[model samples]
Every structure is written in C-alpha cells, then in structure tokens.
Target chain A: MSIKLTILEQMTQVAREQGRTLAPLRDDLALLDSGLDSLGIAVLVARLEDRLGTDPFTNSEDVHFPVTLGDFVKAYENGAP
Target chain B: MALPEALSLRRHVAETQADRFLFDRAARIRIADLVRGTSLDGDPTALHGRSVLIATASQLTSALTLIELDGNARRLTILPPDIDGAHLGALIADAGIDAVVTDGETPHGLHDIPLHVACMPKVVPIDRGRPEHVRTEWVLLTSGTTGVPKMVVHSLTSLTAAIAPRADSDPLVWGTFYDIRRYGGLQIFLRAMLGGASLVLSSAGEPVAEHLLRLARHGVTHLSGTPSHWRRALMASAIGSISPRYVRLSGEIADQAILDNLRAAFPQAAIGHAYASTEAGVGFAVDDGLAGFPASYLEGGCGATEIKIVEGSLRMRSAALAARYAGARGASLRDSDGFVDTGDMVERRGDRYFFVGRKGGIINIGGLKVHPEEIEAVITRHPQVRMCLVRSRSSPVTGALVVADVVLKPTCVREEGRAQVKDEILELCRGALARHKVPASIAFVPELAVAATGKLARLS
Candidate 1:
C-alpha cells in the first residue's frame, strides 16, 4: 500500500474513533482544517511508521513540516526507501 | 565540626521513645530487644572495618542488622534479595565486599557472617563497647535507565542530615510503599528511627489493600509512596478507610492530577512530594498540594541546595550530594561549581516550575517536542485511568509519535464500557491537550508493572 493511503486510512481510523466522519482526500486539502487535529496528525505519523518501517521526519536532520495533504504525502514519499 | 561524630544507630535505638520500634507482621520487635540481640553473634569485632553486603529478604531484619553493623564501623551495601546472582557477584567484587549477612541461605562462594544467628535466644554475654564515633559509608544501587545499576556511595550521617531530632510525646507511626533496599524506602526507615517513631514495614509481595489495612490497624500517621503507587492504592476500596496525618509522594514525577486526587482522598493529610535521586541525594520537597515547587526555589530558597536550569534540564547542588559513584574511579559527579545535572526537564509556568519528563524520554513529532508525562497527566485526570505509561512510537513522517498503555478503573472492565471510556479519554485529550501532545494510540493494560522503587516501569 502507498504510504499516503496508509496515512489517510489511519487518520480516518482516528476520526472514526472520535466519532467524526472525514470527506474524501484531495491534494489541496488543508490537513489542519480537516477533522483531524494535531494529535490526529501524530497518530497518522505513527500509523505510517508501522506500515513503512521508517520515519522520514526523524531520519532527516532538516525537513519541513507539511501543511497541505499533497505535501504530507510527498514528505512520506521523500522519506521512503 | 567533623560531621558531628556520626550518630550511631545503636545509641538512637537505646534512646528511642517508642517501645515497639518495628512490626514485621510476624512479631512486634522492641528497640531494647533489638539492641540486646546484637550480642547473639558473639562478637562482630572481626567484621568491623570490612565491607559487608547485607541482602536479607526481610526488611526488619535488614534494618536491625544494618544498625548493628554500622555501629561496629563496617561499610555496608544493602542489596535487594531478588537481585540476580551474577549481578550480585559482580557488585560484591566491584565494591570489594569481604563478608555478607543474610536472613536466608547465603549464596555460594561468599563469606557469610551470621547476623540472624543472634536473633535466637543465646546466652553469650558479649559486650561490644559504647557505639563508636566512626564514619560509616552506605553504598546504594541505582536502577539506572541503561539497565546497569550504578552503586552510589553515601555516609550514614549525610543520609540522615534532613531527619529532624526526636520530639517529646510525638507518636508518629510511619509506613511506606517502597522496599527498604531502595533509597526512597531507606529515607522513611531512617526518618522513623531518627524521630523515635514506630514503623509499620510493608513486606514484599503483599497486596496494596492488605498493606493499607495493616498500616491502619497500626494507626500509621505518616505514609509515603510514589505517585503511581498512590494512584493504584486510591483505586482500592480500602483506601478511604485509612487516615494518615502526613502523606508523601516520591520516586516519580508527582503530577498535579495525582496531587489533586490525593488531596481529595486524604483531606487532613499534609500532602508533600519530594525530589531525590541516588546520586543527587535528598533534594527539596513541595507541600502546597501543587504539582511542582515554586520558581523562587531556584535561587537557593530550598535550604542549602543551589538549584538551576541548564538548557531546560534541572541541576542541583547540596551538602547531601553523594561523595562519589562506587567503582567508577575519578568520575566527575559534579561540575566545576558543584552542580549535578539531574537530567529532569523542567518548564516554568507563571510562578512555578513543572517537571515535563526526562530529557531522553521526550517525543519529537515532526520537529514538535512533546513530553510523555504531560500527556499522562492529562489522561489520568479523567478519573477512569488508574495508571498510565506514555511512551514514543517511531513514525515514518514525524520523528516520533506518542503512545500510551492505560490501566483503567476496575468498574470499566467490560468491552462496551472500555470502548466508551477510551472515547471519553480521547475527547478529554482533545480538549485538555494540544494535538501533538495527545497519544497517537492507547492500549488498555490489565496491570502496569511498578519498579522495585514503586514507580511505573518506564517502557523503553
């Protein structure tokens, strides 16, 4: 599975746990404005680590935090082996 | 001025106000009988000036024998009875131990000095002169994060410097959740002796409810435990029945939630939490029913200790600092000005400074830092969490993510109830914490294992 899809699925799981429903994902979607909060982002990161076996954010000394869904997915792609 | 001639434990026992100084469930031992029992070993003169390892299973026996050995001027290293045999041998060799005293069968290849042999009735009229004024060193084992326990050396006088002198007619029955081998437990053991108060020793492998009932039966007025121990005991139905005058929390970060819960549970108890480590010796304590000490304490407001913050980590220097780490030659314990970096990260909030967590334990989420303790404090405030351990989970995108293992209240056991409880906890975190600080995932645990020192076992 793609890291981006895995991240989205985990975020959806977090939303469902909180009893919230998220709309279908899009590249231009503002992640912070989504039903997921900062904690949701954190949970998404953890889920992605489990699926991909490496955390790009921790590996890279200097990496920018993603604001939009496209950038978030790109961050995972760049961190992938 | 030479350390006030090192107060002898034999003299202290002789002058104790309490007739019954210790209760070990099996018997109520009087101080006089304890003083007289030292003669059963014939003469400890040969054992004097030797380094002895006392690894007795019984707390009372260890305390009694420690007094006798210390009075006879023997350097002592008190090890927990359950210590691994290989590790024990290594420690013995490292500390240059010449003899050992045990209540049980002695381990092979170690010279056994029979201190318990004297506990029985023997007609040996051995007079070991008046308690000598000599420096007696105590080596304590620290349960370091790296798994290798460090031997911390301290003198008996330095260990008891904070203990107040015995007062007239003060009948304080002391109780503690820690085993006597640990530094936290030894403080309470010494405190009770120094104040001439009776101690209700909690035996190892006993249930919290059972210990609380025993303490209540003994009319224990002073009690101490780590915050994790207190939270577990608070869940017990028997907790509300015992009323203590003095309550202390140590060996762990005493969060505001635990402090507030303790305050509500024991309104009359003077709730205080102390900060002390094996190498750091005894630090200051906060008693205002608050999470942390006042910011004013940083500028030498806490007795003779000088406290400072070096890049977010708390550092301390005091007269009670350990002389040196045993077996580690010429290792610098303190900086040039004598301040020891405590490794505990502290943050200033208005007028108070709160311990966030250990510097090494912080979780970094995509460049954002979050303290696991801060998340734990929030989750435990929900009233359903009996105890919780927050740790980091590696993330592909973020550097690390927060995860927690929670032990819920007994009533919230059913699958349906647990689900609802988890949801409620998530909502609580959403409201009470930043998004990054909330745990990414939480697994409900049947029980959390507490370290021998009574603190929650930090999951690596």
Candidate 2:
C-alpha cells in the first residue's frame, strides 16, 4: 500500500512549478519543510487550488490544521477538496 | 396618575459661538397651566427645568444648524449649523426662531460654565393645530463612520417611527451595546429621558455578565449588544448566569449562534435584530435574529422602511431617513434608488442570508479573495494568542501574502524570557494556518491601536 499525492509530494510539485526552491523544513514533513510564512502560505494555497481544483484556504479548517511543520503540509494535501 | 414634572422636556435656541442661548420650551407646567403660557414664575415648563445639558460641541452645532418651517406647505428645513455667532445673531434678529429646540449640547467654543436657559413650552400648544411634519421638531447628525460628521435632518415623525416599536417605554429600562451618543444610544437615552427610565452606563472591560446582573437588579427587561460587544460577551459568558427578558442585537451581523445564545440567556425574552444606518434610521424589516433578513429586499408592515439587497450589498429606502451630512459632502455611496449602499457583504443560503464581512475589508492578493476577519478568527482560536490582525502586504512574486501581528494572552506571559512566549505564539499560528494563510511574520505588539470611540482601526 502506498499514499498517492501525499501532502509533501503535492507541496513539492506546486513549489517546483512556481520556479521557487523549497528548502527542507523537516525531513519528516517532506515538502512543507520550507516553513513558508503567511504570505508564502497564501500564495502556495492559491496556486495549489488553481492546479488541483480545490480550496486550500478556508477559515474553518485553517483554525485546526497545520499545528506542526509536517502536520500543516500533510493537512494541505489531505484537506483540500 | 400624574406624570413626574421632571419628565417634561424643553428646547433652547442659541447662536453659534454664543455662551448664551434662548430656551425654546419653558419649565414644568400643570394641567391647568398647559392651557396658559409660562405659568411657573413666568417661565414656561419646557426646558425640563435643567440648568444645562452638557454635550459635545458638535451637538450644539447640530441644534443651531438648521430648522424646518411649518408655514410652507412642504417641510421647510432650516436646520443648518448656526456656524458662527454673527449668523446666529442675525437670525435671532430676524424673528426666525419663533419655535426652535436647542441641541442638548452647548455650541462650540462655549467653555464658560453655569449655563442658564429658559424655554417655549407653550409654543407647541400655540402651534398645536399645525401638523408635526409642518412643524420643525427634531434634528440629528450622521454616525461619522465615513470620517466626516454630517447633519442628517429629521422631523419627529421620521425619527419616532423607527424607534417607537423598539422603545422599552412600558417598563422604562433599556439595555444595549451601543454608545449613548450613537444612533442606538440616542434612541435609548431619548426614551429614558422621555419615559423616566434609569440610565445604567457600563464601564469598559467589565464582564458583560456582571452588567447583565446589574440590569436585572434594576428590573431591566430590554437588552442590546453589537458584534464586538457580542464577541466579548461570548468570551465572558459562563454556562448560565444573567438572563435578559428581551434582547436586541444590531450594528452588525446577527447569526443563528448569536440568536441561540441570546435565547439561551433570555429564555422567555423576544430576541430581535434590526438593519439600520445613520441615514436610514431604524428602517428595514424586523429580524427575529433567527434568519437572514427578508428574502425580498423591500419589506413592508415593519415600519416606514424599504429594504433591498443590491449587488450582494444591502440598500434601504427609509422615511425616517436623515436629511443630509453636516461637514463637507464627501463621496456618496448612494445607489441609483437613492438607497444608500451599506458596505456589508451578504450571502444567501436558501431563504436565509448571512453576512460575511465588509466589502472594503476584503483583501485581494493577486485577485484571490480573502477576508482578513476570516483569517483573524482562525488565529484567535489559539489559546496562547489573544487578538491578531491578518492583513496583506505588497510582495514581488506572490503579489501579496497574509502577515499577522498578534498579542500574547496574559496567561502566556511567563517569567522565562519573552522568547518562550514568542515561540509558543508562532508555533500555535503555524499549526493553525495553511501554507498560504500562515503569517509570513508574526510580531507581538504591546497593544493594537484602539480608537477612543472603542472600535478597532483594521485598515489604519
């Protein structure tokens, strides 16, 4: 069994497409290791939503997810609808 | 039952910049004296016998400002700022103020104290046969939300219609989360003055729960609270404490949760929310605080209000409307219907409408719409963080990104260096926010700038 489109993998794809290098935020979180700030997060979410056809920036979910560097990255990939 | 003599009201007409003004109404009058004029030591029982009603200078300017004359078939609006004493003196000489009520506040530049005045209590009776519309009666100023205070002229008929149904005169005690000087406050104070109700003013930062208990102690039945005030009440609210008999929420959105809380707080009380503006008065359909405003924009049977949702915004046509703004006439947000467009954004879920946020507060980062209030709500959920500002700043690549400035909760302040709290606050935000929504920078400020009037300057 394998996880297709894990949070880290998706974040990497989006960051790469934008021509920006995402420095490793953590080995465990994989892609979200970049520790992008608020503006960075907003830009990434908007771009991710455009590419994946889902909302990554909603008020309700943002209140709960992204507690850890890895958790935030995972939530983005898993949470988008 | 004889009404209290102190409950009687009077008016004074003063020249702008004059320490002295003419009292329009005389002192207290007996039933027998009602037929006659100025029976109390030759003084009319109009001015409510108060030596002076201290108010802000702008209030005095509103009084001498303009007046409407009844002699003309139509409303003769004469309410203009007396502006200067020279102009007021000329008007006094012109016999123009035959019947005028002075604004409660003394005019501008009148630092002199021990203000003396009398009234024309008999003037209304003398002119009783004249229609109220034809008679010059009341005056008001705009809410000053748009930066400049404007004079919104109104007659007793227009102003009273908006407030009569909502007034708590039968019991006399009214509780609300509005400034006494604002429109909501004006209605309450005017009713309190007219009905002999005790005015209970709340001090800042006092838990609203305590205030509710005080109102209950005074046998208060009516209640009101704004959005921010409601949020504070939510913060201060315990499971079951003080319950009001009737609650009114206004000045912002009233959703189902708010309605539920008010209902729970005041189980038997009728809860109502209203849609009104300074220009529109208390116009629009009566909201039960249970649903979005009426599905149809325009509603009748509520009062003299006409309401409509134009282009996702609420616009209203009101007979209780104010005449005009006082200062320089700034850009008008008035729609084609002459209905002013209040900048609130509304969404329709079936027949129910929900308010999202203000249109002006909407932040567009590269055309992606984000409401700062939405983001701030998320940040506030973290216990370690208190209030937070989620705003967008110019960025070269992403167009813009959300940046946050936050204050640590009092409990978060520890003896360990500030670094610990900062780290905790940052950790909390990072966990809560998404990649795009996380603050690029979360700086702790000693305190956010709060206005003297008690509203946050989000844009400023």
Candidate 3:
C-alpha cells in the first residue's frame, strides 16, 4: 500500500476511534482543523511510525512542521530511509 | 524503663506478649516457640560473636534465622533475594561474613565460610542454649546501581527507635507484600515482632489472589506494600476477601489517585503513605489521605526524625538513621552534620509537599528535564486509568520522547471506547503537565511488572 493511503486509513481510524468525523481528505485541508488536535497528531505520528516504520519528524533536524495533509504525507515519504 | 543500648531481637522475643504467631503460606510458628525451638543445624553456639549473613530462599526462614542470630552473631547482614549472585563474593568480604545461614542450598560463593548452618522453615523443639547478650550490628543492603549494594550498618537500637509500643496492639495482625530482607518489609517485621503482633509473611512468586487469601486467613489487620503492589492487589478479585484496618504504602510515590482508589476499595481502612529509605530510616507517615506529607513536617523535629529540603532533595536526620555505610564504600551515608540525603525530590504546593520523582530518574527531552513520575501522577488521575508508567524513548527530533503505558481500570475496559479514553487521558495530561512532558503516545497494557523490591520494574 502507498504511504498516502496508509496515512489516510490510520487518520480515519484514529478520528473514528476518537469519535470525530473527518472532513474530506484533501491536500489543502489544515490538519489542526480536521478534527485532530496536537495529541491526535501525535498519536497519528506514532501509529504511522509503527505501520510505515519511519518517523519524518525524527529523521532530520531542519524538517518543517507539517500544517496540511500533503505536507504530512510528503515528510513521511521523503524521510523514509 | 529505659531502652537498652542494643535492643536485641532475641531479648524482644523473650519480652513479647504470649500468644502471637508468625504465619507464612505453608506454616505458622508461635513466637514463643521461635525462642524455644531451634532451626539452626548442629551447635548454635558456634556462631556466637562471628559476623553472619542470613541468605535464605524463603522469607519465613530468614525471619526465623534473624530472630535466632540477632544477639548471637557480632554482625548480621540480611541479604535480599534480588541481589546479583555475581556481587555475592564482594558482599561476603565487605560484610566480613565468617558464617552463613540458609534454608536450602548454600548461596554460591559463600560455601567456604567457616560456618554454613542450614536452617529449617519450621522450628524443632530443642532445649535452647543460653542467650547471648552481646550487642550485634544489623547490616541492611541498600538498593544500588549496577555495582554491589551498599551495606548500611545499624544496631537493634537504631532500627527499633521509631517503633513505639502501643497499648492495644497485641490483638492486631500485621502483613506485608515486601520480602523481610528489604528495609521496608523489615520495618513491618520488626514492628510485628517488637509489638507482639502476629505477622503474615509474603513469599516470592505468590499470586496477588493467593497472598490476599493468606492475609485473609491470617486476619491481617494492618497491611503494608508499595503503591505498585497495592495497584496489582486492587485489580485482583480476591481484594474483597481481606478487610484490613490500616493500609500503608511506601517505596514509591503514593499519588492522590491511588489513595482515593484504596479508600474507595476499603472504606473502613485508614490509609497512609510513609517516607522512608534504607539509610533514612522511618521519616514520617502521612495519614490525612493525601498524596504528599504536610509542609509542617519540614518544621523543627516533627516527630523523632527531622526533615529538611536541601536543594530540592529531601534530607533527614534522626537517631533512627543507620550508623554508616559498612566496608569501604567511600562515601559516608550522611553529611558532616549527620543528615542522610534521601535522593527523592519533592515540590511544595499549597501547604503540602508532593514527591516529583527520584533525583536520578529524570529524563531529558530535547534540552528540558522531565521526571517520568510527574507525568504518571497526572495520567493516573483520569477516572478510567488505574496505573501508568511513563518512560523515555529515543527520538531524533527531540533526543528523547516521553511515552506512557497505561492500565485502565477493569470496570472501564471497553475495547471500542479505548481510543476515546486515550484521548481523554492525553487531554488530562495536556491540561496539567507541560507541553514537553505530555506523552507522545499512550499504549494500553494488561499489567505492569513489579520488582522483588515491591517497586515498579523501571529498569525492565
């Protein structure tokens, strides 16, 4: 499976588990406004680390914080060793 | 009557009130018979005035051996079961152990001792020899880092200094989830022995349910263990089987959540948490059903022990403190003015001081220092959470990241709603803890491993 699909699947699962309905999974959708708080983002990153075997945030020192779904997916894909 | 220079366990047994028994899982021996019967093989007089080590497999025999050898041996070292076998040689040489006592096989590296007396758990009736009146030094091993444990020297006088004889204590039965070789459990053992109360000893590998059943069978009115031990007992179905009047927690931070949970579980019991260490002796016990001790304890001489906060670390001074670290451990157990530095760090809020964590147990996140226990105390406050262990995981972004493994209350275990509960717990942490201290992720665990010391298995 592609990293984008896996991230979306986990994000949907995490959102559903948290009893939050996700809006459409668009590239421009702001992650903070997509029914997931900082904690949810953290849980997502952890789950992604487990499923994808890479944590983009920990991969590099100068990596920018992802603000949108596209940026989040790009970080993981580019950071994958 | 004035207390003697050295209050021997043998002399205490002779003076104890009649009709008290010490119960292990398999056997119960009347305290009087302990003084009358012999568990030591061959001539017991051969051990008189020699340094000895009590390294028994079972706590019962250790207790039995301790009572017999206290005054007879010039020095008695109570070795806890969890001590690394590799350190035994150095420990033997350090303690000047000329003789060793064991219930079963002799401990490795100590077989060459001049006297290796085999002890039996059950005492046999034999004409007891004359009691030795010599003052014996009681040496207790302090939990240490990877090296051999530090041996703290104490006489019977210093050990029993905190135990005050009660008028109505004869009918009470005492029990503990600690191995009597450790300082915490040894305190309970000494209290029962000196106060003439029957004691229920906990054996290694005994399940919580079985231990509770034995405690119930023995009518344990006062029970003591670490907060981790109590957390496991609270989860056991057999917890409802025992109704103790006094419940005590020590050896770990007793947060308000655990105190409240214990109060809810046994409403009729008086719950308290004490501050003590192998070196500090008995600091003080807080019985107000609160987490930390009252700030008033920091004032001049609260009870027998004096408490002072020196640079955020708790320091105590009292007659109950150990004499000094035995052998050439280099560092003195106390400062120049006679204060044992209990490495527990505490923060004062309002009128009470709460334990943050150990001085050495801190984790560095990015550049900020965080105590795992400080976060655990917050996460455990959630209604659905029973217990939690916060630890550090290596991360490239932040050097180290905080994570938690939590055990939810049995009643609140709903698989479908676990994610919701996790979110709520995160929110709880976010509200109370700092941004960096908040756990990055929380995993639900069925149980947490507790060490032989009755503390959370932090290293594991």
Give candidates' CA RMSD values in order: 5.3, 12.8, 4.0
Strongest candidate by lDDT: 3
Better of 1 and 2 by DockQ: 1
Structural RMSD, model 1:
5.3
Candidate 1: which stretches are off by over 4 Å?
A1-42, A45-81, B1-3, B39-42, B108-126, B130-133, B145-147, B166-168, B413-417
Arranged by TM-score with the best first, the candidates are 3, 1, 2
- For the candidates in turn, chain A alone yields TM-scores of 0.85, 0.48, 0.94
Candidate 2's error at B152, in angstroms? 2.3
Span of 10 residues, lowest total lDDT, candidate 1 chain B: B115-124
Model 2 TM-score relative to the real fold: 0.55
Q: What's the lDDT for candidate 3? A: 0.86
What is the lDDT, from 0 to 100, of the residue B342 in candidate 2? 69
Docking class of 3: incorrect
lDDT of each: 0.77, 0.48, 0.86
Q: Which residue runs of candidate 2 sit more than 4 Å off their true CA positions?
A: A1-81, B1-139, B143-147, B164-172, B190-199, B202-213, B234-241, B255-257, B285-288, B297-304, B327-336, B374-400, B403-459
Per-residue lDDT tens digits of candidate 1, residues A1-56?
77777887787887875556676689888888777766566676666776787666
RMSD of model 2, in Å?
Answer: 12.8
Tell me the lDDT of model 1 at B157. 70
Choose 2 or 3, whichever is better by lDDT.
3
